[model samples]
Target: MLRVASVLSFFAGLVAVTIWIATALVEHAVERDASRRSLEWAEFAVWHVPRIDDLAQGLPSDPAELAAFEDLAHFGGVFRFKIFSPDGVLRFVSDDPGSVGSSLGTHNEHAVAVLTSGEAMTFVKDGREKPDRPDLYSETYLPVYDGDRLVAIAETYMDQTTKVAAVRTEYAIVGAALAGMILLALLIPSGSLWVMFRRLRRTNAELEEAQVRAQASDKSKSEFISTVSHELRTPLTSIKGALAMLESGKFAELDGSAKRLLEMALKNAEVLHLLVDDLLDFGKLATGGLEIRPCATDIAGLVQDEVDRIDSYDADRQVECRYTGERGPLFAHADPARIAQVVRNLLSNALKFSPVGGKVFVSVRERCGAIRVEVKDFGCGIPPCDQERIFEKFTQIDSSNTRQHSGAGLGLAISKEIVEAHDGRIGVTSAPGRGSAFYIDLPFCEGAAEAGAVELRNVA
Candidate 1:
């Protein structure tokens, strides 16, 4: 019973706050609209009121002019009017004529500011507190300017009772309708909540079923990868080795026709070998089974070896790969073998994309506490749009030139994963028709600092 009482008290407090906020919002909106109308009325008075500069000078001496002021107070739905001299002394009041020669004390500064700035200030009142006049009124302190000088300020109070009442009643009716709908919903709480909970449970069950099926599908994919790596790759590697031996002319020297066929076989077999390796690497990365063994290793030397090895591969293009570096080694704490794999991938990618007989440039340098390696190729470059998703697995950019080159697109994705595992970063910069430069930045470790640039070039 105590807990139930506490909950009820909390809910009652929330309801009170919500009602107060709603009421305040409605009041503010009504007041804002009233203020705008009041300003318009003040502007009308500024343009139409006729006094011939007599009011600004002092109380009107002309009886006809005084009568015009008196008639204006009762006309145009205006409740009352009070005119003040430039010094804020009350010059005239339509309702109370006797109280006219006094200074406007507290409101004097505000009236002077409004008149001097040539702007009017307006506000709305509910008028509930005043016992004598309990009706809505809009008061505007309208400034009257004569060329450069503030001539006078007029306090115009207009009746806004009907409009204010209509707006408030409309807001109250809508609020009441919304509250009644909420009460009706609360009355059937058990039925509504029971149906809602049933639907929620049904959704939960479907999600659980989907989760189970996804796990099974993932298991099947792993099994397929295992079979390809073990059963297929082993025989494929041996067959490729045999084909390489036959193409080398050391084992069973053949004629041109046979040699050409053997060369083609060996080339396709190498492609198959690369495809299998990429698939295995991707699978390992996906399952988080691929590990990085970090050690203080020479990053420059590592890159140089990969650069030299590029010439050995019989790719589509026989491009010359150049390695540029300083005299000393740029060392970083990284998995040498994994980094080598990344370098190998980038080099192959560069070679594949390069025009026949074009040059591939490989560079290693220390940059801001990181050892950076870059592989650049002067090929029909990748577009800006495709550069974003180039490192994603199975992402082959759509281009006529790119279509000629084939792979599972897992090389760069695997390279990215490898670099990140070593607390490093990898990316590419390319623009169409210029070239592409793929780079990897590994955190610098304690090693021999490097300076001076030397280039090493090897043509395949």
Candidate 2:
């Protein structure tokens, strides 16, 4: 949630910044063009003022001259020309002659600037006090040169306020347009993210509901299995006892065919007993009822004892144990019986996958403040994709229906749980057909480092 909010805020901020930047650029461009035009008008007025003043100078200072000047003022109305004497008094006005003798106040700084420099000056005013006037005004003043002597100052006021006002309006429009664009950009992705979040929430709700249903179904299945297995156990026991009696010739001496059939029956009964044991183990694991009774046991001795037992059961096969690093009686803080169970499971799995002549190697070492146990086998290794999932509950590599392997595929899963409970990790490394190595690493507690040792053991 925090991550999503951060992303949204970042995008919104980007939109705002982009809009501001674009508006600023447009304003700058508009201002530049307006300033250029203002300067152009100032130059034009300054150059043409001298000719107007010369015609007025030739006429007498009479009513005729006043009327002619008034007529000229009307002709130059576009410039709003006002002629002022050397003493800064208005002599002619284009907008109104009523103020002909009026003072052309200090606002005509442009007139003073032109008279003193014998050049032209332009001034701009943006309307602030006059609501009826334009927002911007440009005025130019030129010294009306009479022969070699300076005469009156000719001033022209141009309403360039329109350009600036237009620019401002354009700026507002562009700002609005950019703001709209930014809003659109933000909305597109934001809406998409909102939809995605909503969909994800809905999917999570469905998944949770499905999980609840699956859990209920699993509970029912486990209960049914437990009840059925319990009820079948008594009947199976009685049947096995009756079969034993028949096999022992208690009822009658069996012929050769009968003897063979009885033997097959006994083998099947044993198989059923093994299946029951596996089911019981699974139940115990499920209920968290698997008990461990620990004692002061020698790790190396226990491992060798189990190896001897397996070897004794199949004397035709060979099993070897090698010791590396330090070799001595080792002790650890663990339920030795549970630890032995993990070891047996690994050994049994290796033997099942290994050929008659294949080797299974077991090694224990102390490294990096931990005890490491490695079981390597030169047998058919698991596929790359299957290696990780192999330890999941009830999962097996050879999943075909006709596969000859026997036993519930819960050994590795149980082994993993046991190792993790002991504060250890179990992992495997394998390459297709190159065989595999399974490793168990456990942190060594104080004074419990020497946990196990591998010794050369004979095949019983």
Candidate 3:
């Protein structure tokens, strides 16, 4: 509705300005024409009157001279006449014999202007001011020059065409012509603009529908992944348990080849299990089904335990893991199991990147009412450009198939989701070839950082 009003206002204002300008032009042209006509009439009067050069200096006393003016006055459309001496004393008034001998005095400015400039002057006035000619009329003062020496000025009133009628006629004709041209000017662009506006609206509507369809497709994809991952997990767990039994219990005496084949199968199965777990977690995060339950969890203990678990799980790895942190329980407001999962992911990443005998360090600290746990490794460092991208889902800095490390690339993204659910922040600081440090900062549980490990145990 507001758009419609704005569009209407714009066009209305355009039309108003155009009419105003057109009327102004018409008025100017009419005034110029009137002045030209008045001057022409004055020149005609001087030429027709007999001996006008001699008689124009004063009122004509000779019978022949008076009769010449009387005959000229009788010519059609003549309203009145005034003959002015060089000093602006009125020598004659054709309409009023009483005004003939008076001085024009202050009103003689128009006469003086004509005398000094040796040019014609003309203007329109109401006729009610004159008794004999009570209608609309114009007055003109044309210079009567006798070969360059000014003789007198011929002041005459002509009442042939009223100014109001000319204005009305001019306005009608000019208004119609200009209105047609302006309408044509407006119609051409308005049609094009209308077409473009409709096309833009159609394009916007199509884009909106495409967006709705895309959202529905993404939701379906997450649901399918969640269902498939859940179904694969149970069987995968069963296979891992059976493989462990076969390798340890009675199949321990198997031949060398069989043992080697069994180890490879077990390793591949574990890898498949980890992939399925990551997929399931990713689906939950995407669907907004992932949640955290907060409590006073010992952040230092959580880091140490996960580090040990990763080292034991990957015994073939030739990397040394070191931990330097608060000796006692350093509590943070977090869910223990979820935070442990985050620690495991960070530790596993650190160990995978560490070269032979290279050390990975884990530390915990409390500062600014928050508990921060950090994992550092002296491995091939991340570039500044890829630091933030590493935390995105399914992303790897070395994405080629021949890259040494392999995973679903959902670990750090999942860790980010989990930490944020507890109102925590995670980030990394590193330089190329200088290794990397990844840290998670979580709010400290109230009074929990100050409480002793013994006190925590008693509370539990």
**Model 3: worst 10 consecutive residues (lDDT sum):** 97-106
Best by TM-score: 3
lDDT order, best first, reads 3, 1, 2
- Model 3 gets an lDDT of 0.78
Candidate 1: lDDT over CA atoms? Answer: 0.77
Clashing pairs in 1: none
lDDT digits (tens) for residues 404-424 of candidate 2: 676668778878877887778
Query: Cα RMSD (Å) between model 2 and the true structure?
Result: 7.6
- Candidate 3: Cα lDDT at 454: 62
The predicted structure with the larger TM-score, 2 or 3, is 3
Q: Candidate 2: lDDT of 245? A: 92
lDDT by residue (94-158, candidate 1, tens digit) is 77654544453224665677766766666677787886554778777766655555667777777
**Residue pairs clashing, model 2:** 136-161
lDDT by residue for model 3 (1-460), tens: 9999999999899879877976676556545665676556556665676566555555446776676676555454555777777655456667653443435322467887888887677666677766766466667776765556666666777773455567767787878897889889989999999999999999999999999999899889889989999999999999999898999957467888988888888998998998898899899998888878887888888888877777765667778888888755788878999999888889888888888778899999887888899999988999999999999998999999899998978999999999999899999998888888999999988677666556867988
